[model samples]
Target chain A: MATAALTLYELAAADAALRFSPHCWKTRMALAHKGLEAERVPWRFTEKAAIAFSGQGMVPVLVHDGETVTDSWAIALHLEQRFPDRPSLFGGNGAMPLARFVNGWADTVLSPAIARIIVADVHGRVHAADRDYFRTSREQRFGQALEDVVADRPANLAAFRRALQPLRRALAGDAFIAGPAPAYADYCVFGMLMWARCISDVELLEPDDPVSAWRDRLLDAFGGLARSAPTARG
Target chain B: MATAALTLYELAAADAALRFSPHCWKTRMALAHKGLEAERVPWRFTEKAAIAFSGQGMVPVLVHDGETVTDSWAIALHLEQRFPDRPSLFGGNGAMPLARFVNGWADTVLSPAIARIIVADVHGRVHAADRDYFRTSREQRFGQALEDVVADRPANLAAFRRALQPLRRALAGDAFIAGPAPAYADYCVFGMLMWARCISDVELLEPDDPVSAWRDRLLDAFGGLARSAPTARG
Candidate 1:
């Protein structure tokens, strides 16, 4: 039986080629890790109807062989279970829960810290249809205008870097967060930084930082899949 | 040839039975998880000469068959390497690097946050000979007296609890950070909480928090090894 082609709805910028959502990047990297190819569908934030079939309003909505997976973490799990013979995403069963902790840290701590530094830039790069929705939702979340939220980018950037001490220390002895190789844990964090990289010009990491070196390695991973993506800065 | 008994130098309080150092608790839990018995030697902070042979000024210095291991992380790695046949501290090779991230998070983020709330309490519980040294070192670190460091206890306590959000989220779906069973990752964070529990009367975790429940499970782990420890509150 022929397998149906996997389709991924990714959060795209005004130029659909610029896919920058951190969560979607996680799925993108996971697919590349698993050696799976998917048909990329550029999605705007306000295009809820586009992914309504997934029973959720999220950009990382993956349609795999007629099965719909909404969350990025779930998509990675689906890919892992579906393609057990491929390179492992979590490395082992033990790492799945541990990766979840990394996922949680990225979601609650790292991404939020990056968001404060890049949300305003994000607003400028999003699709015209997504601009109002993104600005409105973010303004409500930050309780200020998008520009105002990033008005103190210097302090926000410092706090963001400080929040990365754990990641920095973790990478001090290893090439990647998952060990010597890039895996879901590294993807979980790299996706966030990718979000900033794709949408903003602000330098988030110093070149001398261990995290920057790790990010460079990841950018060169899977034949430079993430590096090839179009960035707003470009 | 008979194997020599393992000896662990653990940081002790005014009453030697009240072992309160967070790092020591990590080694303690790792030892129990590995099902290895070690003779606990009570070490006070002022007595740096006591562990001079190890070339370190810290407790949790594990002396195994004449091989001395300093630092909680090093001891854990030593135990894992020395007893590969036993229950794994890291569930698999993939988990070691991932667990290091957890260790780093506990060390840099969680422990420091907890110390702000409990430093004064910790100062009160150290051995009389160690009190002056402890207060002086901590004051120098905080740039203020111990009492003044924790003067904003309510705010510090709230911040500490907020810092546990990642842990709380991680434990929400699994019983332990290493998945269904407790491993080095769980021990790393649990050791920090145990530090607060043993030294401070300040209530760190709320009753209904998932983290509190996870802590309950660890307290009951290894036939209630941690729960059996004497807290300064009593």
Candidate 2:
């Protein structure tokens, strides 16, 4: 399958085994969904020199057979276009853009909501070299100390759940966001939850919530690929 | 085209030309996208008996030949399956469900936000006979008087605009939510905008907003079907 040539630089925590960045998980799940494997290189927040060639400071920089693809959405598109013979990440025509809306909701809405609940916890899990950098960068972006950002987690968690009504309604008639099977849209939202799942024990979704059930299905997909990620919960 | 037997029961305002219900507008645009015309029937809120045969008190009930289909999503699927040769509303395999997510967002998020700002204005536009029922029912549901619900519309308007970041982000890459062309997803969000357009003079979208541009494109689609709707600003 020529898997040896494919590489993905993924964000790692103090424990190299803990790869928890939501954006990177998106590429991870997309690779699994496409039945492709890549040598995952553990990257830390302070290690810009490792991915300097990509001209970006993101963890999900993909080096596919020497051609680099950065950004989760760009990586997914590269896989879909390069591996057309494989299963489709976008089920049909026009689905990609609409799925982008789901991606937008996850990025602009869901991820921020989840971050507000777990950003401080995430600061604790970063490697010693990356810890101060992560905290400062994130605190500056959020305009709050990392600890204060998550002070009202219980209330924030409730808002997070309410923010999922669109997803809940989307799933009211289908098993997945892309319908019938998990696709890029599912991965987009799942990646955010996977971020929460990989680092924290804060139960972002209730055990019985439809979204939780949906996340369970994805966690069990690709032979528990996401579920196997190290978490504070365990 | 054998379009003679289809009929769509749509909600009407006091003048009967002001068709503002968001759900009905979805079916309206879907039918236009299909290039199949229906004899539009003006059904007021109090005229439940007009569409009782569908076993639901909804204005978007579509009677095609001897069969009746209620609900916008159901009607869209029905139209797609029944008119396979028409312009495809979903575009591809998983698109129906992803489009449903857009539908869900429009229904649960966009419409509610629009209602918070313009619902009281809608009360004044309903048929005289339905005014009392509309005011009472909506007030009871909102737990506030008709006027009070939109008393803080200036603030609600800000939140409404903020809530549209996902849509704004989605449209950032494409001319429409469904990509380069208009489809059910575009119609779903457009329907909500049309609801605001049909009954309120308050501007929900800025002139340069991407969503406003997308709405303008749809208003120009199908020979200006949406643009022809009587708007309060007119």
Candidate with best DockQ: 1
lDDT of 2 at A62: 96
lDDT of 1: 0.91
Evaluated at residue B34, the lDDT of candidate 2 is 89
For candidate 1, the per-residue lDDT at B33 reads 97
Compare the candidates by lDDT and give the number of the best one: 1
- Candidate 2 docking classification: high
**Clash pairs (backbone) in predicted model 2:** none
Candidate 1 lDDT over A38-81, as tens digits, reads 99999898888988898889879898878888899888899889
**Every model's TM-score:** 0.97, 0.98
Task: List the lowest-lDDT window of 10 residues for candidate 2 chain A.
Answer: A1-10
TM-score of 2: 0.98
Q: For candidate 1, what is the DockQ?
A: 0.87
- Give lDDT tens digits, candidate 1, residues B1-234: 345589999999998888998999999999999888899999999899999999979888999998999999989999999888889999888889999999999999998899899998888888999988989898999898888889998899899998998998898878988888999999999999999889888889889999888999999999999999999878
lDDT of 1 at A121: 90
**Two-chain DockQ for model 2:** 0.86
> Retained native contacts per candidate, as fractions?
0.80, 0.89
